[model samples]
Target: MNGGVVTDERLQPDYEADDSSINNFEKSVSLKDLEGGAGQLPEQVHTHHGANGEATVYGDFEKDKEQDVEDLPTTTRVVTAQDWSSPDDPENPQNWSMLLRAYHTVPPALFGFTVTFGSSVYTPATHQITERFHVSSTAALLGLSLYVVGLAFGPVLAAPLSEIHGRNIVYKASLPIMMLFTLGAGFSQNFGSLLICRFFAGFFGSAVLAVGAGTNADLFPPRLRAIATSLFLLAPFAGPSLGPFVGGFAAQYKGWRWTQWCILFISIPVYLTCLPMRETYKKIILKRRAKRLGIAPPNGPAGLAAIKILAPYHFTISQVGLTFLAIGLGVAISTASAIITDRTLYQKRHRQALAEGRQHAAPEHRLYAAMMGSFGLPIGLFWFAWTADNGVHWAVPVIAAIPFAWGNLSLFISTALYLVDVYGSLNGASAVAANGILRYSFGAAFPLFTIQMYEKLGTGWATSLLGFISVLMLPIPWVLFRWGPQIRAESHYPTMIS
Candidate 1:
């Protein structure tokens, strides 16, 4: 062991470790203390992605030379970290052909599509649901709120499962269960049954939503990541944007029950893809190989809106659903620009970092176009709010939603990338989980009062109130961008090369 840390020099294969990428080895993970399965992880860690897209992981723990070894069965061996057999190992997800990597990426993204789709599709059916059950319109919205709240907390559980078992298992396990819940929702005879089914559907469906990106990271290395992620991110965005539009048509042509059926029917293909899916996590793959060899190694790894104000402008159920296309327009623009940004700005920074003799680029590079969203989120809200009048053209307020969505999409993507860069894979999900809870919980709780807020305060003030709240949170990204290093240095969380 070098510097009180374990090193797999014997396992280093053809790849050379970029010494610059290695951080303090003694302060990262304590392998002796970690278990065979999912190990306890520190709150934060610094990871430097090397030129080849592989990370050079370093951890601090003295070798347990005195531990018994001879007494173990021949089928068992001391477990240590495993490395790829070679730089070009076909088994490594990072080394998979670009087309193959993308195929893997798309399925999970589509699974995410099903999730957000289910979330918003229910919105257009609210009126029918309220009437059918003799419940207030406010009560019908619980379907949306509870589903989102599940989206929030479901990750708390699923992220760790992905760490322990790999993403495919979670995806495979959650989808059918989610579908079952959706079926229960479609067939529910009572309001309580519908609400219950919606919550459970969201809880199960969120498995893919939570860990799909981790699958992306497993497949794509740093250079191709942004572009791939942009495409992958499009699924969820497109789902929510298109959901109401489609649901509106479904509700019009069929009934509210058809909305639930639509989600299930569309998701069938995503479920089919999982039958051929391969595991992407390298650690889990190595663990499987070790199980065969008996080597004990440790290491584990929206919506809302459109309603009261748009009634006069796009009054028909189908028209209101058509209004959701405005959000789709915004998502499409952001996604296209995101692709361009990936090809140009992201690549430029990647190349520059390599040339400057640094293995990794600063996470702040992601925040450039994203900041306008922070300041402009409120602008978009107010623009749509004030302009949403009876005489004003419906298209005007609809156009306003474009910027709101642009800001929303850019900020979320940028922030997520920042988290992965800052915390790395090991702890990034936890960081994201902490934030997602508040995000989705409020998402759920807000709708409970949103209609009331809009009806009582008028659409202008109600929307403006959301804008105002967004303004209060505006300083968050800036603070992190400006003072991140200092904050990280001072924080209790430890840093690792991992």
Candidate 2:
């Protein structure tokens, strides 16, 4: 037996483990359930100390005494999960220094940025694609739409996979494949091949869509998560906005195919940089800990923007990409505003919670940023709708995107932080997975109908329609803020919030 750790490798456990050395050695009946990587880990795997003090490995999941997997068979195989050498072990992610944590944190964010960048990066080339492929504009738009829809569906499986495999392996496995498909799209001779490649690229590339928040949870505690989360999230929020900008120039100067080529060039560096990241999931570490005594580890765990040009603007397609920068600029402003709000509002309440001897402030307290920024979407939409005309200077319409971008970032951060606060890491992956499905689904659907809406309803009315939709949905966070505790209690998620 390897280091007194028994193997159920190939679905058979070695009960030869010495009971004496395994003093109080433990686990549930699910050991064999992990045979083909199927089953949940028993609670109370193990924990030592937090960065500050005693920390339970899986948040507040109190362990329950249960039937040992060994007992289910014949002789019992006792295992001491020697996961960490000590409570304050540097290997434990929570104990990592700020620099070390940042090292692990950035790759996922960059990789995510690349994927979102890919989402709309090709949009600037829609005209080029239509001409080359002999397709209509709507069909050309499907390259973007299919990719987003692909992203929406991937979280169904990716989140659970991350929960099982840990975040690093998922990224490693998916990013290269994503890059490969992207390259495939670039080389495709036909529209069918190109669209298929785009969908798979987004599908394989979707790991970050669901796992990023869980990674954030793995590295930083709630108090410090806001700033790090804001920064990490900025890459994604900025991606779609910036994609057209980059793709426009690339397509204009080089060709439509260069849009995909540029993505491959960008993604290679991101993937290569991610190759060395350490695992952050505690269950996986604890599984290895049980493995040192012997065993397995635990289980796991978009976009748009691309509007076209008209007469007064006299903007080229590539310049159209530049105009989309207004949205990116909005994204940047929103991120800055989020960081400021975190310090002024969220952190202040955090300090207050600590003073009250509580571990977390209310999840609803996270809503202030969302509440404040909610106006951006509709306001920007209406502003763009009405002002993006031959009558007004193009800059006026462009300026409208700033508030819209701000509102998007604010709401996104608020939702993410709130969910992370409510669910912690393990379950947070699944929670965020559900969120990803809905989020990307919407991301996918928007581009498909947006142009149609712009055409049928007229840009003014169509854009105003979206604005009105945003206005209607604005009460959601307020309702959550008002009744979140009661809803949270009824839902029965193991929240970290007080």
Candidate 3:
């Protein structure tokens, strides 16, 4: 007797049946069942097949289904919010640790201090330079003016280049060029040679002033950027004030050429200090990181996604350009005011009095007073230029300038802070470009007709012309304050308020 696998009412053979007739009969029965007729197989047998054999056979199908679920793609998701509520997300540059931000900021500040110190140190050394080159005081002033011109224009090219190359590259390249020119400036034999070299040196040295601002934004977030910006701006402002003090002494003791050499000596240590400073611009840093990770660099949508995540508040180039223009215009107006009031008018009248040996010569303090009296550079220029021949005590113009330096510093500081606050990480490069363009163009153009104006119209009228220009520039700050929000809203760059 054959023993087959048993169900409740029928048996299924697990092995081949000994008789072929039984197998053929089973096939016929299955075909009849497919035609919708009931087979001879019992219900208990069907239940047994369904519970044991069919269930066991379908078990492998479930296992394959689970494997498919495991193979589905997964991704990291970002939640974009309109404000700065989170502190730990990588999106906020402010979220970076204090030590890291400091690392990015210190070098640029020192660089600015060094460069500006070098630039203006020549002011007190003008006499030494004149004696060395056998040129007049006006000609020596021209050399100083030429350097400022370089400072003005260098940033236009440097700022754009930094966008293409990393900041470190521009800094390293520009610094060395500045050094070479500063060093060469010492060896120049004639006035023209010195002027050309000084001009280029000013141009290259401007990198510190312009690029440093942008670098600070890269390191700090908007909430904390004001302090960083203040620190950066402090260098340039303080440098000019202090440079003449130090350069005066150095030029007095060591000679004018040594002023250039001393700066170069100081720069060596600063340059070496920059060795450990890492590049902070997110795009360049991440791109290099991707190469190291053996992943393909992000492209198209992926790249944009990463950039947007990293920099949620970035500004477009055009906005930055406009901001720079406004800043430049303001700076030019201020400078022209200074020239109109102080150099063209005050100095001219005061010197004339001394030359003629007037009965009651103006006290030297009048010069100081004129410098200190104005609301800013322009007011000081206005007071000094307008009052030069007024027959009042010379002390009046000098008293006026005291307010001028004060006001100028205040306005300049405020404007710088506003720009940094408005632009965030892009501040450094954008500021550099703006400063370079505005400072140079204005410095060059303002002084050109100034001498002629004073000579033709005399000090009082010449300064009044400048005072009127200052009044025009006065509306700039008010306009910015009122419409700044709308302007910032449209910017593609990151701003402090955003």
Window of ten residues with lowest summed lDDT in model 1 = 71-80
TM-score of 3: 0.47
Candidate 1 per-residue lDDT, tens place, 299-392, comes to 3210123345333654643565566566656655654555466567766887999999977667766565466567657778889878885468
| TM-score versus the correct structure, for each prediction | 0.48, 0.48, 0.47
Q: lDDT of all the models against the reference?
A: 0.65, 0.66, 0.54
Candidate 3 wrong stretches, greater than 4 Å: 1-96, 287-498
> Native-vs-model 2 lDDT?
0.66
lDDT of 2 at 349: 89
lDDT of 2 by residue, 158-214 (tens): 665675567778888998899889999999999989977987898789878777767
* RMSD list, candidates in order: 24.8, 23.4, 23.5
RMSD of 3: 23.5
Pairs of colliding residues, candidate 1: 79-296, 79-297
Tell me the spans in candidate 2 whose CA falls farther than 4 Å from its real position.
1-86, 295-498
Task: Output the lDDT of residue 489, model 2.
Answer: 74
